[model samples]
Target: MGSVAVPSDMPATSSAEPSSGASNSPNSPSAEGSGNAEEEPTATPPSPSDSMAPQGKVTALRLADFKTRWAGGEGWIARTDDSGKSWKSQLEHKHIVNQLFALNNLEVWATLDIGDSKQLKLLHSVDGGAKWAEIGYVPNYSFLHFVSSEEGFSGNAHTKDGGKTWSKLPQPAVIAGDAYFHDRNNGWAVTQNKDKNTLDIVRTTDGGKTWTTVLKRTTAASVTGTVIRSAGKKDAWVELIGDSGMSQTSYSLFHTMDGGKSWIPVLANNQAGSGPAPGYKTGQESKVPSNTGSSPGALYVVNPKVAFMGGQCMACDLPNTMGKTTDGGKTWINLSSKFPGYGTQLIAAADAEHLWWINTDNAEPSIIYTSTDGGEHWKVTHTFDKPQPTTE
Candidate 1:
């Protein structure tokens, strides 16, 4: 596997409260579901936190599209209503979902797949996802995310919509991977053009009035995937894939705390991709070489001490891939085996003890798993895509 592009985040990036319009159904909390990503009028909500609860309290889980074959996972969104007791799916667009976000419990935005024509699909469900409406269907873009319901943006081909709908930004800052926003004033996105030798990172404040591209760092020197994000305006990180394919080297992963201003390496190897691809694990001993200073393996920080790193145990196997994070990508550790299959389907920390991992395995629906003890154990909380038809 040459490299992998993965998107990792703790949760909501804005301070706005989610909207509440829809009520929960008597669906009987099926152990398998995707958490509601908004504060709908239907249930109570959890207190705001800088980071998500690491125990993976995802009350619900669902696929991007059940009508089509898997693989075109446009994006996802989550919200905890009723004090994390249940979740609701907020998107019902006919096209693919690119990015799902909650400006607040009531205010939510999801960028769906707008075809190459001017018939784009920009969905907004004021009723907590039970139903969606095409707020505005503009073309000339395929991917986008919002800093808030009042302001949002995305990037894609300019063939449709005459490129008029999307305000052209400086430089050809086309991105291919993940994007993030600290708030309504600042946001960023990464590009994997390869030939460009740069990771297109863009930020906008004062709503979407303008955009500035940070092309200082390029992906040419990285074998891992790149994502532009900030846990908060004061703290941000540019996480990359920890190599898991060929080398058992722990420091195959890397990240930057200064919002892509600097770069650092970690002994992290992600368990993504296939055939020559690597896999990821969790635990303390399996984290890295157990050295000091910069010799760390992989690091991901939700907050100062509220973090985790890659590690391993006495009877552990490299599995060619795993991840660990310290306070600030410092002390590394390893993850658990609850994450079955590979290829960076999804990675999240709902809280300190709850971690969520969704692997991309077309072979089965058991792609979503969760860890309540930080990464010690995992449970197949849900399965997606439904089993396919077989020959008699």
Candidate 2:
């Protein structure tokens, strides 16, 4: 089946808005450095006679440069070497590109959506998008997660030969969203049991060959696992939403030290009772207004102990707040009073001390913020402009 679409106004803790089809605005942020500032080159779409096809829209960063798959495929990949000032086109394929994974500026992977009749295909490039080779095919899959070029998971299969070949593994749950691997040998997958209205989590120790259910529960409300990050085999963090009665929902954060055997509530707040998790800390209760439908904002876990959490106050006029916990979710303190926008979309951590986030709360020309000293302070890095019309 094709990927499910989530509305843009949904709470952050619920479904995530699809990033593929959004049009790039001209007023988006520009690169700081100067060189050539004009429309980037566009690649010609692959023809039936071409040897390889490309697909999917995946974006990543290597140092200062940004790389992204162009919308509707058209066989063009965009890269801005000098930050966001100027861009150049690379790679062209016949199929629509759905996702792009950059190991660096050199090695990258692209997943293609080849319509419903045929299985999805994977392509790889090692020389900075100069050329691409067909790696393998994944049946009924639309996403790609690779820890490295050689080690990664696509659909229900794991690949070790850099996508040249894939080994079909045991599937985890029926409605699995994404799989996060701490390494090639160990990882976690999150799924939702729609009938039970409960979230299910499973772990794989030997790549994706096998999985073991670690946690399953329905605590008086239907929940959806938003994001999961593992610091190691035993320590991990999860963001989830709990639906209360009468069209109300609560967002909560949990931590696990025993490989999901047990989870400790680090933070819980919403229209019901906004406060810190028990035994973690006091004074840091959430400031979101009641009846506004709050949810877990953004979570970035650098290690077992060092992490950042953003609490989103949905449909509220008040600004959102973020908290930090350096002692493994034991205690949290206010990191930022209120972000400039309505909500945060992505929280990527370069390390424990450096982090970045993009605000997506109904704002125009999205802004990217970076924090070098944890979340203590932030500065605007780039403003994403709407993509220009393609001539393919």
TM-score for each of the candidates? 0.52, 0.60
User: Pick by TM-score: which candidate is best?
Assistant: 2
lDDT of 2 by residue, 19-41 (tens): 22212246432222221112323
Per-residue accuracy of model 1 over 192-304 as CA lDDT, tens digit each: 45564444445555443555654344332332444344555534454444233332322333345554565444443333221111122233233433322121222334453
- Candidate topping lDDT: 2
Q: Please give the RMSD to the true structure for each candidate, in Å.
A: 12.2, 11.2
lDDT, each prediction: 0.39, 0.52
State candidate 1's TM-score.
0.52
Candidate 1, residue 275: the lDDT equals: 16
